[model samples]
Target: MTAVTAPEEVARIQGRVVRVLALGQVLGGVAFGATVSLGALLAADISGQESLSGFATASVTLGAALCAIPLARLAAARGRRTALTLGNLFALVGIAIVVTAAALRVFPLLLAGVVLIGAGNAGNLQSRFAATDLAAGERRGRDLGTVVWATTVGGVLGPLLLTPGEALGRLVGMPPLTGAYLFSIVAQAAALILYLVALRPDPLLLAQRISRDAAGGAAPPVDADRPLAARYAMFAVAASHVVMASVMAMTPVHLQHLAHAGHGGAAGANEAVTLLVGTTIALHVLGMYGLSPVFGWLADRWGRVAVVLLGQGVLACALLLATFGSDVQGIVIVALFLLGLGWSAATVAGAALLTESTPVDLRPRRQGIGDTLMTSSAAVGAVLAGVVLGQWGYGALALVALVLVALTTVLSPLARR
Candidate 1:
C-alpha cells in the first residue's frame, strides 16, 4: 500500500470507499444473516429432525469460534480485503459441501459444511470493524449502522426465498429446501466480487497509515500488547455477544415447539413455523444492525464502555419481559427485539472499544481472540439452550435468561470508564 494521504484527501477518498464498502457489508450481511436462520430451518426440514437443528447451528458458531482470532491476526498482518476475500472463499466451499450433503442425504457432512459456513461468518462478523477503520472517529457508529441497515433487504428476502428454493430443489431432484444453499453460494460469491472491486488498498491498511501519521510518522506504539484486559476484554465483550447469539439461536426453535404442541396440531404448522422463524430473523437482524451507527457514534463520543452498560441494561429488561409471557408469540418477538437491540449496542461498542484499547499491532490479534471467545461461548449457549428446552421447556429457559440478566448487573461496573 501507499503512504498516508493528507487528511482532506484521505477524507474524500476514504469516505467514498467506505460508503461503497458499507453497501457491500449490507449485501454480505443479508446473505449471511438469512443463511443463519434459514440453514437451521433447512436442516430441520430436510433431515426431519428437531433437536439436531441446534447442533447444525452450533457447528457454524464452533467453526467461527475456531477461526475468528486467527483471521483477525491475518487481517492485521496482511489486510482486511485479503481476510474478507478469504472468508468469501471459505463460504463458497462451505456452500458446496452443504449442497453435496443434501444431494446425498449425509447429515454429518451437512454439519461439517455448516461449520465451514460459520467460518466464513467469522470473517463477515468483522465487517463493521472494517467500516470503522476508515471512519473519521465521530461517524464510526453511523457508518457501521448504515451497512447493517442494508441487511434489511437481504435478511427479509432470504427467508422469503425458502418457498421458492424448496420448489426449485424439488424440481432438481435434490432435497426440499436444499435450493436455499444454492442461493447462498451465489450471494456469497457476489459479495466476494464486491469486496474485490470496491475495497481498494483495504480499509485496515488505510487505518494503519493514518495511525502512523498521527503518531508523527514514527513507528507507532504498540498498545495492543498490554495487559489481559487490554488484549481481550474477554469477560465483558465476549460475554455480551455469547448471550446475544445464544438467545438468537434458541428463539426460532422455541417458536417451532410452541406451534407444534400448542397450536392444536394446526394444519399449517410447518408454514407457520417457517413464517415465525422468518419474522424473528427479520426482527433480530433489524435490531442488531438497524441502530449500529448510533452505537458506533456513541462509542466514539461517549466511550464504548458506556454503550456496553446501556446494552446490558436494555437486555436485562427485555429478558424480564420475556419471562412474563412465555406463552405469547408476540412476547417472544418483543423480547427478541430488545435482545437484538441490546446485542447491537454492546457488540458495536465493545468492538470499537477493543480496537481503541489495543495498539495497532495488537488490534487484529485481540479482535480475533475476543471474537473467537464470543462465538465459542455463543456456540455453547446454543447447545445448552437446546438441551434446556428439551428437558425444562421454554418457560424454564426464561428463568435462566433472568439469571443471566442478574449476572449482567454484577458486570455493569466493569463497563464503567
Candidate 2:
C-alpha cells in the first residue's frame, strides 16, 4: 500500500504552492491596477475630448464584459494556461493598437484599443480564481486578499508616473500622457512572462486532480447544483460590486466639479483638483483592495453571507455620507475612503462566497457571468455618471448614489440569512 502523507506535510506543500501562485498574482495585480486607474486620464490627454474619456473607460470595461464569459468558457474547456496565455496575447495586441492610435491621433481607434485592453482585464479578474484553487476551505479570502494588496503597490505607482511619462511621450512623438502606455506594455509583458514560467500544473486542474485521487477516482464535482442560500449570496456579492464600480468611477469628475464651483478653493484649482482626485483615488483603492486579506479570512470563519450583508450596510453608509457632504473636501475624502473600504469588504467576501457556493466545473461559468455583470454594470454607471453629473450637478449625483445605497440596504438583511 502507498504511504499516506501526513496532514502537516500536505499543508506545508500546499502553502508553498499557494505562495508561488499569490506572488504571480501580485505582479499581475500591479499591472492591472496601474493601467485601469489611469486609462481615462490618458485617454483625455490623447483625444483632447473630455467626454470621450468616459467612452475610453467604458471600452475597457465593455471589453471585459464581452470577453469574460468567453474566456471563462475557454478556461473551462481548454485549461488555465491556454486561457491566461490568450489573455496576455490579447493585451499585447491591445497595447500595440493603442500605441498606433496615439501616434495617429485617432479617437475612435484609441477607444477600440482600450476595448482590447479591457479583454485583458477580464483575464486578470479570473486570476483570483487561480489563487483560490490553491487555497483550502476558508482560506480562499486571505489568498485573494494578498493579491489585491499587491495591486495597491502598482496602483500607487501608476499616477506618480504621469510626471515622467509625459516627458517620455514627448520624446516618442506622442502626447505627454502616452508614455504611460509604454509602461503598461512593459508591466503586462512581465506579468505574462511570470505567468507562463511560474504558474504550472494549473491550480484548477491540480485541485481537481487531487480531489479525484483522494476520492479514488470518484470525487463529485464541486458545484453539483448548489443550495438556494448560495445562489442568493452570489447575487448579493454581484450587487455589491456593481454599486462599488458604478460610484467609484465617477468620483474624480465629482472632485473636479466641486473644485470648479469654488468649494475646494480658488488659488490652486488645478493642484487642488489633482490632490483631491489622487488622494481619493488612493483611498478608494485602499478601501477596495487593502482589507481583502482580513475579509477573506473572515469569510472563511464568519460565513460569506454575513460578510456580504455587512459590506452592503457599510457601502450604504458610505453613499449617505458622500451625498450629504458632496461639496466639502474633507467630507468627500472620508466618504470616498469609506466607499473604498466598503467595496473591499463586499468584493473580497463576494468572491469568496462565489467560490464556495459553486463547484469546479461550474466555477468559470459562474465567476465569468458574475464578473461580467459587475463590470458591465459599472461601465453603464460610468457612462451614466458622465451624463448625469453634467446635467444634474454633483449634488444630484450624490442623491442618486444614495438611492443605490438604500436599495442595497433594503436587500442586505434578506441576503444574510
Candidate 3:
C-alpha cells in the first residue's frame, strides 16, 4: 500500500513552499522592475528614436512568451527548482549584456539582453502557479495572492532605486542609463541562489507525487468536459494583459515628452524626468501587485467571472481618464495606477479560475500556454501602441486601448461559472 501523506504534514510543507516562493517573488520583482522601468528609456536613448521605445517592452514580453512554454515543460519533467533557477540564470546573463550594450551603444544588443530578462520574468509568473501546487481549492487564491503581494516590495524599490543605481554606475564610469541594471544582476543572482538552496522537495513534483499516492498509482478521474473551460480563463488573462501593456508601456515616453514643456525646469531636465518617471512607474507597479491579495480574496469569495468583470470595469475607467486627460500629469499618474490595479484583479482572478477550470493532468502545460498567449498578445499590443503614440499621441493610444476592454466585457458571455 502507498503511504499517504498526513494532512497536517501536507499543510506544513505547503506553508514552507509559500514562504520560499514569496522571497523569490521579492527578488525577481526587483530585477524585472528595474529593467522594465528603464527598458523603453534606454532603447530610446540608444536608438535616438522615440518611436522605437515601445519595442523594448515588446521584446521583454516576447522573451517571456518564448520562455513560458519551455519553463513549464521543464517544471513538468524536472521540477520547479530547476525551471526557476534556469530562468534567473538567464536574467543574470541578460543583465550583464544590457550593461555591456549600454556602454557600446548597441540597440540590438540591448534588446537581446532585455529579452533574456523577460525570460526571468517568465519564471516569476510561474512562481505564482508554484504557490498553488499544494494549495487547497479554498485557499488557492489567498496563497497565490500572498506571493504576488510580496512582489510589491521589490517592484516598488526597484524603480525608486533609479537615482541611487545611477550614482553607483557613475562612480564606475558606467553609461548614463545602464547603472540600474548593475543592481539587477545582483538581484537575479540572489534569486537564482534562493531557488537553488531553499526550494526543497520541489513543490510541483511533490504535489504530483501526493496525487499519485492518493490515487494508488492510478489516473485520477477528471471531467472530460471541463478542460475546455480553461479557454475562457486564458482569454480573460490575455485580454487584461494586452490592454494593460498597451497603455503602461508608453507612459514613460509620454512623461518624458511632457517634461520639456517647463515641467522639467530650466536645469537638469533629464534628472527631473527620470525621477518623475521613476515615481510614476513605482506607483503603477505598486498598484499592480500591492493589492493583489484583495483581488485574490474577491476571486475566491466574489466568483471568478464577477472579479474579472470588475477588473475590466476598472480598466475602462482608467482608459477614460487617460484618454481625455493625458496632458495633466496628476491625472495621468492616477490613470496608470488604475491600470496596474485592473491588471492585478483580472490576472489574479483569471489565473485562479484557470487553475480550477483545467484538468489536473494538463494544468501546468495549459497554464504555460496561457502565459505565452497573454505575453505574446501583450507584445503585439505594446508594439502597436508605440506606432499609435509616435504618430498621434498618448490620448489617442488610450482611446484605442479602451476598445479592447469593452470587447473583453462584451465577450464575457463566453466565460461560464
Candidate 4:
C-alpha cells in the first residue's frame, strides 16, 4: 500500500481529489438535472397518465438507492475510482436506453434507463463522502461542501439545455423530449474520464492506509459493529431528503397546473408553462447547492446537530409556505428555493457528522448503508407524493409531509452529544 502519512502530502492529494470530484459533480449532476426536468413530462406522455409522472423521478432515486450499497462495497474492495467509473458506465447505458425508450414510447423501458442513471446519481452522492477521505478534523465539512456546491452549476445548466437539446433532437430526427439527454451523455462521459484520469491516489484507499499507520499498522476496530452516531446522521440525512423529494418531485407538475389553470387549460400555453417550470426548477437547483460552503463552514464552527436542527427549521418553514401558498406561483417558487436550501443544510451537515461518527475502517460500508436508507426513504416519499398530489392537491401533500419534518426535528437534538 502507498504510504500517505505526511499531513502535507495528504492535504495536497486531498485538494486534487476534491477538485476532481467537484468537476465530476459538475458533469455528473447534469444527467440528474436533465432527467429530473424532462423525466416527468416524458412519463406522463408515454404512459398517458399524469399520476405516473412522479414515478420517473422515483425511479432515479430508487436506482440510486439500489446502487448505493454495491458501489460502497466496490469502494471498500477496489477504490473510489472503480466505483465511480462503474456508475458512469451505468449512466451512459441508461442515457441511450432512455432515448430509445422515447422513440418507442415505452414507459417501462424509460424507467429502466432512468434507474440506471441513478447509479451515476449514487456516485455523485458518494463523492461528497470521498471528500472526507483525507480531510482534517476541522475542515471536513468545508471540503465536503465545496464538492457539493459544484453541482449547482451543472444542475442549472442541464435544465437550461432542455430547449437546445430538443432543437438538436429535431435537427437529427430524434424523439421530441429525448434530445436533452444527449447533453447528459456527453457530460457523464467527460465525468467518467475525469474520474479515471484525475482522481489519483484513490482517496479512500489512502485514508485507509493512513488510518492503519495511525493505529500502529493494526486494523481499526468496528466498535461492536455499531455506529450509533451514524444512525442519527442517516436519519437527519434521510429525513431531509424525504421532505425535499416529496415536494420537489411534484413542483414542476404543480407549476404546470397553475399555468394551465390560468390559461383556461389551453394547450397553447404549454410553452409558457415549460419556461416557467424550467426557470423555477433552475432556481431551486441553485438553492440546493449554491450556499453549501456557508453551511459547511457553519457546521464546523457551530455544531453538527445544531446545523441539522437549523435545517429542520428551514424545512418546516418551506413546508408551511408550500402548504398555504400552493396556488400562488411566486410563493411556490420561493418555497421551492427554501426547500432546496434546507435540504442542502441538513444533508451537508448530516454527511459530515456521519463521517465523524464512524471508525475509519467502517466508514465506507456504513456510509453506503446510510445512503441506501436515505435514498430508499426518499423514493418512497416521492412515490407517495405522486399519489397524494393526484388524489388531493399540492397543499394537502405538503401539509401531510409536515409530520416527517416534525419527527426529524424532535429526534435530531438527542444526538447532539
Error of 1 at 365 (Å): 0.6
Which pairs of residues have clashing backbones in candidate 1? 69-368, 141-293, 141-296, 141-297, 142-293, 145-293, 223-359, 224-359
Which regions of candidate 3 are displaced past 4 Å? 1-4, 216-225
Relative to the true structure, candidate 1 has a C-alpha RMSD (angstroms) of 2.8
User: What CA root-mean-square deviation does each model show from the true structure?
Assistant: 2.8, 3.5, 2.0, 2.1
What Cα-based lDDT does every candidate model obtain? 0.73, 0.68, 0.87, 0.87
Estimate, for each residue in 192-294, the C-alpha lDDT of model 3 and write its tens digit. Answer: 8999999987888877777666655432333243544578888888989998888999999999888867554667878888898899999999999999999
Model 2 spans with C-alpha error above 4 angstroms: 1-13, 42-52, 217-224, 258-276, 412-417
Q: Which ten residues in a row have the lowest lDDT in candidate 1?
A: 217-226
Mind giving the per-residue lDDT tens digits that candidate 4 earns over 1-417? 558687777778999999999999999778778888888888888998888888888898899999999999999888899999999999999889999999999989999998998877887788999998789879999999999999999988888888778889889999977788888989999999989999898999888877767766433332233366678889989989989988998888888889988999777677767678778888889989999988999999997888888888888899899999998999999998999899999999999999988877898898999999988888888888889999999999889878988898878755755
Model 4 regions lying over 4 Å from their true place: 216-226
Model 2: how far residue 196 lies from native, Å: 0.3
Clashing pairs in 4: none
Q: Candidate 1 on 98-135: residue-level lDDT in tens?
A: 87887787888888888888899888877867776766
